[model samples]
Target: MGVHPKESTAQNIENIKRQIGEIAAIYDWDMEVNTTDPEFYKWTQWIFVQMFKKGLAYEKQMPINWCPSCKTGLANEEVVNGKCERCGADVTKKNLRQWMLKITENTDRLLGDLDKLDWPEKFKKMQAEWIGKNHGAEVDFKLEDRDEAITVYTTRPDTLHAATFMVLAPQHKLAAELATDETYHCPKKTMVYTPSLIWKFI
Candidate 1:
């Protein structure tokens, strides 16, 4: 048996057509009929293609914390404490290939246009900070065998020593790979498994 629900082929197609028709319809109290036609879907698809062509949409392998009960991946922010938001099951980290959109690519233009728009000052400031417009150097740290390196962008290189040890996010490539090894698999062995420098710093 499949882990998910199953429907007959006829039922599935009928359901799809029903949903499409319902979505395309607009109801008015005056009984006037309005509908979102296939043209809307075509336009949406065209815009998506434009985004992809501009490199704003791309696919990459990314680890997501998955909640089996929900049968969906949860964003790191979605987990409360250590449990899934939907089912209260303890969330587990899962690695999978997923799509990533370059939201940061439009950061500067969005931030610049914010001032021209009549919005709340607090909201504007929040948007500006979210864009993270900064004059800084991007330093990369690489592993011995890996050609790729982790980049850290910072304005103050002098405070590097104060950093103690790098705190790699659990979702980071390095952190996830290390987590798979027996030496680092034990959560209770947090200090025991972490590098001596990081352990001391933590």
Candidate 2:
């Protein structure tokens, strides 16, 4: 049976459970639980509630990676080069209200405790890079004919004077603003061009 938007969620869940059961039986694997079951999700909900009560979980409005094909919000780790890691679809930036977990608060402790783990050197290095914390200066660029300014973070503040052109990522929140101006036109054929070539006014 094909799983489509028209299919009921209950039917899809049942289909998944059946397929997993068949695979488990063929592989002689012992599958004790189905996370889709109500009992399992109850505990998951309880944990989220506990985290919210402890202030570790909170909601905020922010820019997030969105997969248009999947129609869902994705985490930073789930996006690679402005594409969805799971579906390989082009991802875009979307501003929406989302729940956020304050994991950065433990960045220092997490980095320091990494050495104590038995993981390989490569794995440790990757974790350290993922927890990337760096000091940078926030520079604001005034928009042409617009009162708003875009703020960018850069480690090399001295090199700002030599910058001749501004390139914003396709998934940037401000990229959509370029379309509002009639003078700035991006050709549809050059959509895949690197840097997206939004506005060329120099």
Candidate 3:
């Protein structure tokens, strides 16, 4: 919040922030660690620059509901019935380049330290689920007819003998890469197997 005065941060955004601050002061909700503090922001900028140099911060294409009229990306909620709520422009899928932080690099440590935090069991479980710190192995299964073998990550490697068929999520990266025709997503990861199912666990 403090450091990111990126080109994206406009005067209107700052105005809204100031307005929020003014309104909060009336209710005595003074935020201690203010983003407006230059002393705090400089350190943030330094840290971000260091992270960028270390390859921890990088850019990737992210699909989103885009509003061409607004010239800005709209959140799913901001799209009303396939149109932008603000300008009523038809929402479209766009692969916008976005800066992403490598939070997965710290996943192991975060998952391990979850028990040390003072939180309810349910909330801790939710955090763990979101972190996706699963104890699993990737088993490489070779296809019978084709030379290419798809890699599947599974928690139940013990059930390999019982596996009859595999199911792949329509949105899996491999789905598009391996598909001969047009394709598409699901929350839970899955495996898809064809008649060429041949197991070679690695």
How well does candidate 2 match the true structure in TM-score terms? 0.57
As for candidate 1, its clashing pairs are none
Winner of 1 and 2 under TM-score: 1
Candidates by TM-score, descending order:
1, 2, 3
C-alpha TM-scores of all predictions? 0.59, 0.57, 0.52
Clashing residue pair totals per candidate (backbone < 3 A): 0, 0, 1
Selected candidate, larger TM-score, 1 vs 3: 1
- Residues 1-202 of candidate 2 have per-residue lDDT tens digits of 5565445666876787799887874533355565666888899899999889989899987777778889999999998877789999887766688799887888899899999999999999999999997778999888788887767799999988888766666555566556545434444432433223345333
lDDT of 1 by residue, 106-186 (tens): 877888799798989998888888777777788776654657666778899877777755556555566645443332433
List, residue by residue over 98-189, the lDDT tens digit for candidate 3: 88889788899989899899999999999999998767889877765677767789898998888775655443334555544222223222
Output the number of the TM-score-best candidate. 1
110, model 3: CA deviation in Å?
1.0
Candidate lDDT values, in order = 0.66, 0.74, 0.68
Off by over 4 Å in 1: 1-44, 75-78, 142-149, 176-202
Off by over 4 Å in 2: 1-34, 37-44, 60-96, 170-173, 178-202
C-alpha RMSD for every candidate: 7.5, 6.2, 7.8
User: What is the C-alpha RMSD, rounded to one decimal, of candidate 2?
Assistant: 6.2
